[model samples]
Target: MSKKSPERTPPESLHLPRVGVETHAHLDSREFRDDLPQVLDRAAASGIAAMGQVFLGPEAYQANQALFDSHPEVFFLLGVHPTDADKFTDATLAAMDAAFASDARIKAMGEIGLDSYWKDVPPETQHRIFRAQLALARERDLRVVVHSRDAFAETLAVLDDMGFKDRPLLWHCFGGDEAIARELLSRGWLLSIPGPVTYSKNVELARAVAAVDMDRLVVETDCPYLTPEPWRGKRNEPALAVFTAARIAQLKGLSVEDAWRHMGQTAAKFFGLELPK
Candidate 1:
């Protein structure tokens, strides 16, 4: 009989130095309402030094911002998602602007961009909302986190047209080919690698990862979504960011600790965060 292979270590066991940052997460979602504190504890134990919590809109921001009042490690990203483009009215923009002005924890504006995957919102409306938010980011002098799904060409065109070239822009959940990666790099934007890179069949994304400059790359779990391999079917939490970082290190031919540390530093700088001493 063939000998059984030993079980792989759980991601939480990585226990790397507290130098990694999870650049994106949706901890406010109902999925994490229970035991959110435990989820955060696991993330801290798994080597995550900081985590970015994305709030979908002004109301979500207002409703959930208090949840993290005690967790100083959790920063915020606020914006109206493209799927809800119809709701991105002038008042929405005003509220977002006020939030930026009022809250120091709100470090950036985004997860805002075009999403062709969902047709609920018309293309023109998505474009208009995207531009509006991008303008807000510029006016607020904050970094931009972009979300582009099945709308790469249009997204690129829009960013370029808006003079975002060589700006402090990060492409969140980047799952594109080498060519797409190179184009974004040439434009002087950073790419946030998500859990999808760990999927065995994601050859295109792997190629893109290998081709990216490590300094221009950061890692994100995007959890409670895009859980990495070995935990693909399960609920994803910030603790699983270690798995994504491990894969990025593997693809980039570096030590996991080194990858974790570098990605944390890069993301911290991108969001103007000073990691706890």
Candidate 2:
């Protein structure tokens, strides 16, 4: 009979300092409806100092912004996802604009780029909505968070056309190779590394993490999704970002704590949040 493998260490047992930032998460999703308080506790105990809670649209934002009322560590990213291009409208933009104007925690205009991975939305419609959001971000002078999937080329073209070069933009959920990393870095954009980097088969992402400047790299769980290795089959949470940081540390030849702290600091600066103490 084959021997059973040993159990992996729990994320809290990693003993990472509370200097990690989870740069992306859909905490508002119904998956956490039953036990969000516990999830937030786990995230805190696992050393996550702050987290970026992404609201997919104006409705989600308005409805769920109160969920984190007691958890000041959670910031916000508001955007109309490309797959929801059909729902993008003037009213949506107006809601987002009003939210940004009134709320200090809403830090960036993002997770807002082209996603051709699913063909439900037409490419033209996605492009049009993407441009509109980009223009809005520029108008508000807010940092932008981008979500590009199988539409990297088109997304880059749109960003370039809109003169986003050297603007404060972050490429969210970056699973690209070193060459792709270089292209974004060249435009002075930051890359938000995600849980998939911990997958053993993701060699290209490993190479990119190793080659990129550490200052330009940030970590995210994208959770309740993209759960990292050792927990790949489970629902991802902000606490699991420690594993993502651990893998990034291994690729970059740095201590996991250092990687965690640095990425946290980078994200804090990028999102205009106070650095973790």
Candidate 3:
């Protein structure tokens, strides 16, 4: 009989925080459908003081609102994803506007922007919807969470053309290198790094995170996806945010506690949330 291989275990640091918050995660994801309570419990136990759920559509927005209402510790971002650009309509924008108008817990307008990775959604349509959402955010005076993939230049151009200079913009799951990062920093946009930074092949992203100023940086899990190493290919959750924080701490030459504290504070200020006393 062939010998079986031993199961790999995560490092001890995985369970210990140096400091962390999961700035963006999707609690409405099917991966957490069965054990959301348990997931949130794990997040709290893991020292995650706050979490932002990215709402993808009307259904997701409603579901996330209910979840956030049930768990005050969880916050949310309201927006339509670029892949769903074709779904944009007068009715849809009105619904989003109405939701933002009434929902105080909905912190920002995002996980919204351009994604040229999938050709299914045309670039022109994505640009149109993104501009519309930017306008909504400006009108509502809400911070914006942006998702730019394989269309960085165009994304920045739109922000410039739409005159979003004064608004607080968060570049979620940032994948660009130092040059792009510097450009964003110059424009006063914040960057949120996810689990991909921990992967061996993502040195460029890791460097970008390290190069960014702490005050302008935020950490995220982008859970149910981009699971950090050791847990790669496994379903991710907010608790995994610690790993990303730990790696960033290493890169920035700061203690885990300092990194987490800074990220938590930045997130709170950007999202206009009150930290638990």
Candidate 4:
């Protein structure tokens, strides 16, 4: 007898218990350029109701604006990434100001924070750009998605000195431990956890997730990256957010439905976006 191949599961086979939103993802990435439409279609099929695309560069900003204009469900965040600190020119700031001033779909300024992972960019330069963007977010009265890596202490110090207490700040793809979680929570900052929380070896993340209050938490894929377990190393999409929600739910002792609802509400409130009925 011939051995039979396993049955292939349909994309829709992943049943999501409740609707959720991806607060930060890079759909404008070159990785998704060719199959963007199909990726979004799969996301919708997986019960993703809303998505926030991070605009890392001028090109990404323009591409993100076009994507949001075409897809009402997709939103945008405008900012220069930490790795691109050198890219912040006067013209770039002007473009960002224009986007903030005129674009209703652009919800926040983000994916902009300190990253000490590379020594090529001096810490002073990172601080300068981060401070500038934080000030802009305050002046514009927009929420911010912060991307802190290996420089959380410095990042938090700058935010404190800048008086970011009144502004809504979210730590995107949070990789901190429980101590950092407590500190951020004490300051009323939101933690947006990615799919890495689902990995068994990510005990630190799970502990941090369980330690933080649910009301201050959100979910994201950070897609085309951090693909999560079961889908690791593959091109991640908003549809894969369900795995993130499920993992968080498991950590928090809440049902997947409740976790989804909590994340959707928290994101809506923070980004000032209306949730679809």
Best by TM-score: 2
RMSD of 1: 2.3
Looking at model 4, the pairs that clash are none
Ten-residue region with minimum lDDT total, candidate 3 = 10-19
Candidate 3 on 245-277: residue-level lDDT in tens?
878899999988778888988888888877753
RMSD of each: 2.3, 1.2, 2.4, 3.0
State every prediction's TM-score relative to the real structure: 0.96, 0.97, 0.93, 0.93
lDDT of 2 by residue, 14-112 (tens): 998888899999999998999999999999999999999999999999899999999999999999999998999999999999999999999999789
- In model 2, the Cα lDDT at residue 135 comes to 89
| Model 3 CA deviation exceeding 4 Å by range | 1-19
Q: Is candidate 2 or 3 superior in TM-score? A: 2
The C-alpha local distance difference test score for the whole of candidate 1 amounts to: 0.91
Evaluate model 2: give its lDDT.
0.93
Q: In angstroms, give how far residue 40 of model 1 lies from its true place.
A: 0.4
For model 3, which pairs clash? 18-256, 18-257, 19-256, 19-257
Candidate 1 vs. true structure, TM-score: 0.96
Cα RMSD for predicted model 2: 1.2
